[model samples]
Target chain A: MNKRENERNPVETPAHDAAHDALAEELEALRDLFQKELDRAKNAPDDAALPVKDGAPDAPPDADEGPVCACCGAPLTDADADAPYCEECLTQMRTRPVHAAAALFVLAAFLLAAVGLYLFSDSAAQWRQLFSAQRAVQEHRLLDAADRYGDCFLMNADRDSVSLTGIKAYADLCRSLGDVDLAALLVDARFPGPLLKLPWNARYRALLKLQAQFAATEQVAIDIFGAYDDYTDAAVYEDVDAQLCALRTDDTYAPVAVEYIRYLLMKAAGKPAALQMQQLEQMEAVDDGCYTGYYLAAMIELAGETGGPDAARTYFQTAIERNGQDQNAYDAFVRVLRRQPAPDTAAIFSVAQAAQANAPARGKPVWLRLFAVSDLLRGDDAQALREMQLYMTACYEQQLSLTMEEWNLYALCAAAAGDEDACAQIETALGSAQLKLSPVIGRVRAGTWTAAEALRKDGGDIA
Target chain B: MNGIDRVIRVLTAPGVWIRSFWVHLLCRIWAVPVTETRLFQNKATFGHLQHMAPPTVGAAFAIGFVPALLNRLLALLLFLSSLLGLFLFRMTGWVALSANTLAFWFAFSLYVNTYPPAEHARRMQTMLRGQGTRAQKILLAPGTFCCAVGSFLERRGVTFLLACAGLAALVLWQGALFAAIARWLPNLEG
Candidate 1:
């Protein structure tokens, strides 16, 4: 491998030739990118021409000559005042003792305008980029967009009263990117003043609520937002509740409503009247409003918080009355009713009637469903068995999806129904199969479940 | 020689030489505005610039006059609020301790007038020019803790109990340290 020998056959040394070829290709690619970028730069609308020294169009190009300076197009020379300026005009312009102050003012104005335009264009570009990035999350692109947005804010710190139309989009983009904390920080900065007054305050509240639910930070949330009624009381008088109520289904509003409810409970923690109001409002959902059963169940729990056993029973009755078609609500109401020493026996009978009537068609299955299991623990074996049949019919007949929790509930119902053989078979199948018991179920088994007292237990060992 | 003459000679001689050396060194260092410099090319300068109080009260005081009673009161309030927030969040003593440290630095740097801003600026310029860098990331700075503390205290309902107690301890310890150090080496300003 002598130097002369290697140089003698440039074509024969395949490896070296290939290496050089690769380098050449890489350089060509890089050059192409640069060319493309340069073309873009050239094509970009030139603002520099907008405010010319005298605000007049530069002199036209000579018909026979190459492109010349639009201003004072005496034969353009590289050494002329503007370089592209005509010699005669260049000399005249230079001799005017270039008013340093005037020139500086113009320069300052130009720079200011340029900076403003640059910032506007950059922000617009960032918003567009963020939109596209969110549509299909590319982490690096999103991060780049975030950085650009941050730069814009930092650069324009002087304009503290900037609008947030673009920033909202940026925050939303951050949310989509799963940078919730960053999105929140941006929101806090960009959305100035008290958030409670915004039209989208409800939605913001809803989002905060959802976040609270997801993060289990409801207590902290309550501390920050104050009581819902207190916050909403004045607003409600102004028909704000109507607006908020209308917004309930808006993805933005749903989380806020849930949050408002949670906050309401927090605020009413020790106040009896406020606590009752929380129950009453929730029961209104159960009574004649849409999606009242969930509210009714929540109300019952809230009632318990107030330590009003009678109020809890009344709310449970209201829940059953509002949705007799929902057997689960009827059953839950009955179970809660049974726990109250001042039980409404008449309501229980009526609820049982509704349950039996609403029981699924095509007969129930052999496995005890969770509803049925709850019945058994509530000292209602017949209702429990009936629910078990419904579960089996849904699973075996309708081929409905049954999670491990459902399966376990079914197995328990079977064991409670004194079908030891059936219970053993279900248990063995469950144990052998990849029946993933949910954390809730595992916690229940381990005596660590939230609101476990609401879950009726007590079943014998499976055969 | 008289005692006064000896003292004056020592003071003037050292001060003149040091002042001349620092001025020459710093004039070259601060030739360029720091904000225009890139972070990577001037890491130390960037760090110092970034951490440079963005013309806030603390920044002004740290390099300016001994913080007035009002400023100390304000700083004390902030220090207390930071501690209260930590306590409400059920944080350990460390957070409160950190907040107290912030208060002390504010008092020492601003109230007690340890380092003059003019002197500090000159020193910084020299360091910046020599090393071509600023401070570290401002977010990871003691200044952040101070700012956070100040803001926390400014919020409605935050008291100054914790801050005042911390300030008392800090002033005492600082005085003791100054006295001890002065015995052997003498005071720079004196």
Candidate 2:
């Protein structure tokens, strides 16, 4: 039958449908046998449910020498085993434990972070809470605000400086609440202990700056060196001194500098006399006419204040030497000299000489000679004659001319010498000069008319 | 009164005559080039007589060290002063600095004989072994501070010496401490 079937295969090749049918029948028979065997094996389970002498099962029903399920330690290598996870442990391994654990950890971290965020969200929440706590004390709620800040320090990054600022705010609030001691305590608490063991310059500066900020305007002077109980920092004293000195030295502050310098010295050095010494030194050092005359006067005044007659005389004498012709300095110097316990006379002579030496060239350079003449007129006849002789020499030898006032002095000198013609000549010049003088000048020239009276007559002091 | 009589009264005033005389004298002194100040000037030299000249380093040192050494010698004469105390004497730098400058140092040594910074400890030695005209680091010793004597000769002279000394000492101490720490924490080397 196989030989004839084999021979018929050629015909099957020739007809594809018949050959396909034959092959399908063979596959069906094999499938039927396989299904029967699988059914038998499935029905004949539970034979190896063995117990040991210890009354425990020797092995699991599906145990075999192979890799087991990681979750239940069940042998899972078999291709066709009922309940592949050994029936009892099938539900355990399929779930996602690693992923779930990760999710749980992340959730826990999120909750912690959220809690932190809520605790220290912003100053707004703290502000609200404090505002609600209305009390007699002004902003007594600041204590609570401080407490909130302290809580934030434990959780937040960048805490140190923030905490310090909060502490300062608390201190300010306490001060506003009329709790000065508590405010002081707040400052103490806020100071960084590790960094500041000795007296801290920063703290001192802060205190001074604060004083400058809050002091009552009426209670404090605008000057840098004004008296204040809290102006204790050495650095502050130095800074203020420097600032005031800078202002005094500045050309812009020059017109008012004299007054300010006096005030500054009186406040800083606590001695009005120091003003004189400083002014004298500055005058000697300065090259410009920036308050030169003012400085001389200041020195005189300082000497007067300190009752240092000798010092006053010396300063005046020096000023006279520099610019004796400048009536302002001479007058002020004379005033100081009068204030002395004992006035210096020689200084007047030297000042006169200095003035003569420094006088402007050409016509009647006699301001210094006049100072000498006045000194001579004050008492010393010999000195007066000597000054007059010197003046005459300079006038004749240098071809210099004398104005009317200078000629008056010459006339007086001639009268002393019994020279009638010179006196007459001076008198004629004086008369002519007087006649030619303007109304204002004529009024000033009249011995009876004061400058103020002349100014009143003119209706203004303008030239 | 007559002008001559008035002039006589001015002449007789107590300070006036003397001041005027002094002014004339000052003027005379000022007129002489020999008496003129040579400070910050080029005309000054070893041979010439000058005025108000900048102090030479040797002269400054001599002036500073003489009085200081005298004071120290006096201390030695009185009692066997602590060598350290002698070095820290207040008047040790008085010819160059201020009086009462070493009160703090003396007090500190007496009460807390704690180890001073290395540079502070080395100050006297540096002073004794000075170089030629090294610039002053500090101008004046404070009431209580440890600064090198050499620094007092230099410009920008206040507290700079002490600070520099302190910094050097701190660096040395830190280096030593770091070495010890390195040995202790071997793992940190990595």
Candidate 3:
């Protein structure tokens, strides 16, 4: 206060007191001016910090009853203005109930859940159909498999509607069966346009084309050989004679062309074996050495008995040479070699070793198993056991479902190697001694059988 | 005094008796029901202001509709003013060198406007701005509280009914304080 300031300064004399009083009054005026400036800057009203004019209840309370906010004094004359108090201050005084906001949040949440459930239902039904089709296929009901798969095509044949789950399920099933061409035949006859709209539809088309050629070949084979169980089981036997003439025309499908040619050779029988030989030469000229090509080469030797020992040897050698990364070519060529008169153990062992050398270069697990059998036939017990172990490990790595016969064959390998521990591992891995076995496997188990019996009865098909 | 003797003394002079019974309460601001009670010696000392106090308080509770609401609005304005004054830069204006000047004036309006009679109004103004008796200060508490309650009752729905109830309670409460204050009137006049 100015009084306090005067006391602190201690100015003396009437003139000094008068000067101090005058200065105090001046300072007081400046202080008031500063305070007014501060209050105005803060948007505080003029009387905002003032009390009622004391001892004057007689004075008019509102003076004139003009518009002035009785609360925070913002002007109320402009557009969107409110009197008595500004709109913001007045709203602060009133509280609305919270239940309306709570209702909105719940409604929003329910709508979100409804949308999510709606989107998921379509894909979920598609998945369920695929699973049931797999179940039917496992049950050996081919008609049911085709029907369920057809239902899958109906759910979404549109490219935009197809999901990764559908494509992956189809691809995995085909690859797991290891018979893309035949399995496609069993699941089709639906004209496949919708299936063609699917991802990886090319694989399906290729296999399907292979399947058609195979059907044509089967028809021709049935006409010549009669409906032998080995030749025909899934199709009509009587249609064979009606379809035989179709084989004379050149087959367009690369996969089953060899089979079609073999049937043509059957149709050409006694028409001078030279003509049949010329047809085989022409087929070989166009061959690209896929698994079908090498298998057809071996089949050519078998179809002509007079191709002789050297010709048989040449075809088998060439088949093994043209095998590339696939396991099937070696399997077919070796099977024929094992069935050879005075079976060529040395040549088969050399071929198996060369294929074994290709093992690390993306070679198939089936090649290792074939080599193990080759090693066993060559009487190399340790090499056979090692290759067999490698084959089992490779099967496990590839998630290949091995059959009971393969399990029994592993048991035989263990027995031949004289390793009790290896035999116990096979039993433990198979989880039961009462495993399903083919009769040939039962004969091998009885210890009165040959290695050829175990090798040739590779019994995954029955299981 | 002993408890029984004091109780008897209070019972004799009903005006002072009612005032003294509230011993620990220590202050009396409201004028007693002067015409209704035997003030004996205190009645002779009555000035026009003293005579008007009780009637004025009764009329105040009855007439305090808009005034009561205005008093509450004043209190709200005072609070906002004080909040700004505290938070903002504190360099002084000539009039605002001291703090709460608006609040002091608002409370002054509240006290004066809510009392409704000239005499009570004057005394209410005195009590707000100047340091008065301990009794005067204590009585202001209920007086302000009654004003606030009466004010809030008129803020929204069922205004007439709730305001009437609030006013009735305020009148009775104020009458008691007035009675207690009146207990020493004769003594003060001497």
For candidate 2, write residues A1-463 as lDDT tens digits.
2221211122111123443677899999999998997777777756633324456456544334666543366665453132223333322222212223323423433343343233234332332222222121122223333344334333333433233333444454444333434455545545455433445325523432333332322122365445444443556655655665555444433323434453444445454456546645654463133334445666665765575656666766665554334444554554454334444556555554544444344212354455544543355434554666677787788776655444544444444445556556656766776622234433434445433233224321211
Alpha carbon lDDT at A52, candidate 3: 76
lDDT of 3 by residue, B1-190 (tens): 2233223222222212222122101111222211111223232211111111222322333222233444344434443433222222111232332333433333322322232222234434433435444564575546644544533332222243443465466444642432343342332210
Model 1, B63-167: lDDT tens per residue?
A: 222222333443344334332222211112343335434433333222221122232333333333343323433322343334334433422112233444654
Model 3: CAPRI class? incorrect
- Per-residue CA lDDT of model 3 for A44-74, tens digit only, reads 6657655577799667656554465445665
lDDT of 1 at B52: 19
Give the better candidate number (1 or 2) by TM-score.
Answer: 1
lDDT of candidate 3 at residue A197, scale 0 to 100: 65
Best by lDDT: 3
- Name model 2 segments beyond 4 Å from true: A1-289, A294-311, A317-347, A350-386, A392-412, A415-420, A435-463, B1-190
Q: CA RMSD for every model? A: 31.9, 39.4, 32.5
> Top TM-score: which candidate number?
3
The model with the greater TM-score, 1 or 3, is 3
Residue A349, candidate 2: Cα error in Å is: 3.9
TM-score, B chain, candidate 1? Answer: 0.20
